[model samples]
Target: MTRDAGQMPEELERAQRFAWDMESLYGDDLVSVVLYGSAARGEYRRGASDLNVMVLVRELTPAALRRAGQRARDWVAQGNPTPLMLSHDEWLRSADVFAIEVADMREAYHVLAGADPFAGITVDPADLRLQCEKELKGKQILLREQYLLFAGEPAELGGLLVRSFSTFLVLFRTVLRLSGEAGVRDAEEVVLKVAARAGFNPGALLEVHRARASGQPPRPTADSPLAVGYLDAVDRVVTYVDRLVREGGAQA
Candidate 1:
């Protein structure tokens, strides 16, 4: 498809050009070029967010990597992340492991070239829930470590929150899905719903988001740690996921 519902013209054109380039470089070896992440989600910020692309191929080789290295470098130099290259067999086999990412892209992606690899795909709910809990806890650990290291610098502490907010949003979306709240993609709506469901104050999270959007470090909300409320919010989410009934199959 040449267009996605909410994409801006420039973004769409760039994605199409990248797809065309990949096709021209790899020919039939390239299975598909999919646009996902924030850009594909209609949450793109021209100067800030990444335009995440995933290229699926019949086989991934050193030769293939060498061929696309320059183009990938140019793309990253333009402020986007390096394009993700995966083999078709790997894509199918790893769905059980990368369920969170696969399912998100499956739900929100645009197929810029070839066939839609996610068509008819269904992620295992047990895998999704397990990953949800694992990633939530893992992120909580990462945040604590960040806090311990940067506690002295309030602005850097705030920067940690701003940098990590987007990642937390992705995690929150997966948790909501496991909790039976699917299809809530709006940023503020996701925050509100997650706060309601997880029983955390959304204030700190929203503040972090505002700081991120405004391109500034968040102000200290509490005296000591500066991000006390923010850390507490993440902790609550970890605890909430702990109590969740591990759901799977049809009901999940």
Candidate 2:
């Protein structure tokens, strides 16, 4: 099917071209190409956000995978995340366990080619909440272990902070959604909204977002109170979600 790029931004137009390139390689085997994450949601910052793409194929056989793998390398080399390759069958079956991912993509996405896989899809709230909690705590543990390894290095710590904070912001939206508040799509605004709802001071996290967006090193050192405050903010967020889970129960 012919796709239109007339309404999209230059970055997204480029994404559509990449999608068409995949179609050229896979032909009838290509099921769909979609643009998701911040870019599709209209919150993308050219240098700060990734242009996430999902390419669905009729089958992911070895030969097809090899062809797609070549495009994946070139895509990343051009600064986009590797396009997520999933067979059409797997896309239908995986949503039960990957509820949060499906829900997030379904919440906002643009179909660049083929059929819209996310159309009419539904994600179980309980499953999404469970994964959100699991991922949140898992990342928290990773932060502690990694922090020990980079304890005093300002640059390394800053880089870690920049990369890791974005995940929490993504998870934060799900946490808020569990409580029936998913209207906001901007990650920074999501953090502020969650902070007010959960009663944590959003200042430290705001600083982290600022640092990440500016591509600047976090001003505070590993030994500084601000670093400690960042962790404290994470802890508060985790704890708040835990309470919401227990109080609202899994289905809520």
Residue pairs with colliding backbones in model 1 are none
Best model per lDDT: 1
Count of clashing pairs, candidate 2: 0
Q: Which ten residues in a row have the lowest lDDT in candidate 2?
A: 243-252
Q: Judge candidate 1 at residue 183 and give its lDDT.
A: 78
- Each model's lDDT: 0.82, 0.82
Prediction 2 TM-score vs. true: 0.91
Q: Which regions in candidate 2 have their CA more than 4 angstroms from the true location?
A: 1-8, 250-252
* Tens digits of lDDT, candidate 1, 82-184: 8999988888888789988987787688888998898767788878878888999999999999888887777778778888999899988887887788877
Give the clashing residue pairs of candidate 2, or none. none
